[model samples]
Target: MTFNLLLSLSIALTLVAAAPGPGVIMTVTRTLQFGLTAGLLVVAGIVAMDLVVLMATLAGLNLLTLANQPGLLTLLMVIASLVLIVLGIQSWRRPIILRLDEGHASVSHFMAGIAVSLTNPVLFYLAFLPVFIDLDALTLHDQIVLLALISGVLTLVLGAYALLAAKLKTWLFEQHPERQLWLNRISATVLFILAITLIHSTIS
Candidate 1:
């Protein structure tokens, strides 16, 4: 949990949060339908689940660290790097279309947010975390700070998305497909860079 690691995670998470996805689309669609508060609820739900996923990942990472098997850890890191690279390529090749499904009337917007998060999940962010977080050196204070970073960054970034979903819905998603394409590329670029950085760190 070095400052550089936190900073890199913050920047990378910001970009990932801002990228187009089911979560973003839900925020936009719900905001357009129910209003800003509704959108924030959605963000809240997503953030809640994100923290859950992070905690679970941290638990598994702790077990890996405690095993004291550097070779196994290194192998996993290599695998994770390859996965990130493949994800980058797939995202770069994918196209985004703006279509809003009429959400279930019985489900609350907050619940819908949780469902979207669960459905698409945080595999991308999960891959990004172990690359930067050194479990061997992680103190309790560092763990607290790390959790704070994840929650705070997500809240600020996704909250901003919810705040702007109304304005951006038409201009960004609906009208200019190119703009969305660039966003997708940005996410892809981040993924590729993370993969390379992880490989370098593991070997070095």
Candidate 2:
């Protein structure tokens, strides 16, 4: 709704996307196995899934807002904070078990991307974002802007991973477990920060 909100969203998404996860690993792996093209396909698949998740979240939030229930905003904010906090803690605690034994039986990298996105445990994290943005007040134009922003962020983040994978074929990142742990810590911090920011926004 505001430039500041849009800018914050962009920055937040960039950090989130950069955080090491199944999606990023898949992108890098595909890039190494196939090429940048395969990685791009995976990014596209992830973005498609992102669209689905955002739409579903918006619709569900709209339903709640339309009901004119009292204290709904506060309740949603609490739910959002709790969800983010849980995700942050889980991210910090989750163990990295790289499954590189893929058979590559998929018909196309594009489809594989969709499959990974669909199975992404972090997918529904998108649902908790309504606390940060006023989903019920978004206009059609705002929706388009949001979509474009998200698409751009996804492309930029995943595309950077693809390019990096292409350039550093010898460095697949799996070789360094420490780096993954750092990524997890950074992601967890960001999630916690987001939860705090949401609560602050609602309260003040």
Local distance difference test scores for all models: 0.65, 0.65
Q: What TM-score would you give candidate 1 relative to the actual structure?
A: 0.57
Task: Using TM-score, give the best candidate's number.
Answer: 2
Candidate that scores best on lDDT: 2
Q: Which stretches of candidate 2 lie over 4 Å from their true place?
A: 61-107, 122-126, 170-204
What is the per-residue lDDT of model 1 for residues 1-204, given as tens digits with 9 covering 90 to 100?
667877898898888788887667656555654456777887887778677666766665553342244775466556656756765686588676456332233235566566456444234455677677765467778877877887898788777877786565555556655665676677567657656766775665
Q: Which 10-residue span in candidate 1 carries the lowest summed lDDT?
A: 100-109
Report the C-alpha displacement of residue 166, candidate 2, in angstroms: 0.7
In Å, residue 164's CA in model 1 sits off its true spot by 1.7
